[model samples]
Target: MSKLPLEGYRVLEWGLWIAAPTASMMLGDLGADVIKIEHRVTGDPSRGLDAGYGSKTGRQSLYEGFNRNKRGITLDLSKPQAKTVISKLVQTADVFITNFRQSVADRSGLDYETLSKINPKLIYAVITGYGSKGPEADIRAFDGLAQGRSALAMQAIPEGPVWVRPALGDTVAGINAAFGIVTALLVRQRDGKGQKVETSLLSSLMFQQTSNLALHFIGSIPVAPIPRTRPTNVMLNMYRCADGKWINLYMPEADRFWPNFCKAMGIEHLRDDPRFKDIWVRAQNSEALVSVLDPIFASKPRHEWIRILKEHGCVIDIINDYADLPGDPQVIANNYLPEFDHPNYGRIKYPPMPVEFSATPGQLRRPAPEFGQHTEEVLLEVGFSWEEIAAFKEQKVI
Candidate 1:
């Protein structure tokens, strides 16, 4: 294997929770050397986040999940001595990422204008709740608030508005921030100039819903919550099997797959029925068609239906829960979830970088660091002597 795509890059991250840290983690996964900075005393608040939902893991899982492939250091940014360390790091960093509000960044001298002076080629990325400018820019927000404000919550559940679990908004914003940072890095490579790159939870989530939002924008159709029971396309809906399991069909091209699908369900006569002849007519009579098809699907167990549909080349599969993912053959073949030997947790598995490269593949080289684990080591690399490090520690500035 060749060197990873970002092997020579250096990233400095001042992030909390998920967004900015997740962005830096992506860069680190591609082989950048990421340095995570935290408050000397409290560290990232996510270190204490509970897994909840009856998960067996403790609070450390959240922190470990977002912070792997990075070095950890602590510093009191408010302290005067801490400025020296930051300035030195900025001078050598190729990228700087922060999820701090504008005011907080300005106060800590971590703003783009200040850091760009230290390293003109630095790619500075910032993540926010709303945006850098606006009345609500500085207002604190988390995943749920972003989902509600961005209208994602409205589309999440059929009955009423409800935020999606597992921090959809934060994760999207983080991925967007990473893309922006990588784009900026490419631009810097061309022009030898650094620039500020910004992303927000609201903007990311809005972009995620672009196709649905365009219905209202261009077609005069109002975007609304999708009803699972009454699907507009009967061929593209889910049905319950005789064994009380669910199977989903995704035959979007109704005309192309009509014969095969009908043949698979032992309802080949429906293929010529006028009310369900074409895509449009089938959609118009979807409820009646669903009524006709649901019983046929429910006549067999999920595995039996899966086999029959697959044999006929109808696009169908059994619906899987989270527990089904680990042993999934396709997932294992693609290495989507890779196992790692963690010092504290023993054998564990987590989702790796999503993309694969033929020549420069990514690797998970290290686990998340312990609190301030590499403070002295990082300081030494930045030209700080043992005496200075001790003094900084003595003054609570490390």
Candidate 2:
């Protein structure tokens, strides 16, 4: 196999939770030598959270998902000696990432200014809940807070604001941070100098909701929460089948797909009906049309409806739970979810990073490390001798 795209890059990450750590993992997947720094006492807090994968017992799979392809070490930064270790790592690191709050970072002496002084060519990437200079920048936040602040929670449920599951804000922010870091690396390649790259959960969430934000802002329309019973477009909505399985139809261009969809759903006469004649009329009478179509859809099982709808070329998808995804034909055939054998957990599968390069394709290098698993190995690489490493361990600094 060809060498991975980022084979020669080195990343030093002090990410505590999901966003910054996940960004480093993305680079690690592409073959960066990522050394993740954890608290000597507890390590990454994620290590304790439910991984929700692998066997019922063992390491947290969620942490494994975000942290694969990287080595890990623990350091008690409160010890002055830890600064020398970080400075040594910074000297050769191409990228340095952290999600520490402004005050905490200042106290720890890991801010961009401090690290940049140590290595002018380092790409310093920072992740925050809000933008760096904002009034809320110092305030603590998490995935749900960003979702609520960005209006995602309000849009998800019109009845009342509720947090969206799966930590979407954190995931998106991590992807955005990765994009920023990569762009900075490109800039360094051209200018022989590195710069600070920054992204925030709030900013990422806003970007994710730009389409709706644009309509509300640029179009001079106040955004309203969409009720579950109504759809902005009748052609794109979820319907339930007799077997209680649900499917989604997403024929965006109503005019082109209406006749075919109606025929496939066994409602051909409705295509010519006066109330449902065109896109405008159908939309105006969406409730009535939905009332007519719901029973027809409920007349058959989801699988049968999927078969018929697909045969007619109507854009549709089955509403699948996370468990259904592992056995999904498309997911398997396309290698969207890749499987691996964990020594302790047996065989396991995780979602692959979606991007593919014809050459230099990324792969999982290893499973998430045990806490402080590589402290000695990493310290040796950074020039710490065995005697000094042992002393550091005794002093509770690694």
lDDT of each: 0.90, 0.88
Q: On a 0 to 100 scale, what is the lDDT of residue 6 in model 2?
A: 94
Highest TM-score: give the candidate number: 2
* lDDT value for model 1: 0.90
**Could you list the CA RMSD of all candidates, in the order they appear?**
1.9, 1.9
How many angstroms is residue 88 displaced in model 2 relative to the true structure, after the best TM-score fit?
Answer: 1.0
lDDT (tens digit, per residue) of candidate 1 on 200-229: 999999999999889978898977865656
- TM-score per prediction, in order, is 0.94, 0.95
TM-score of 1: 0.94
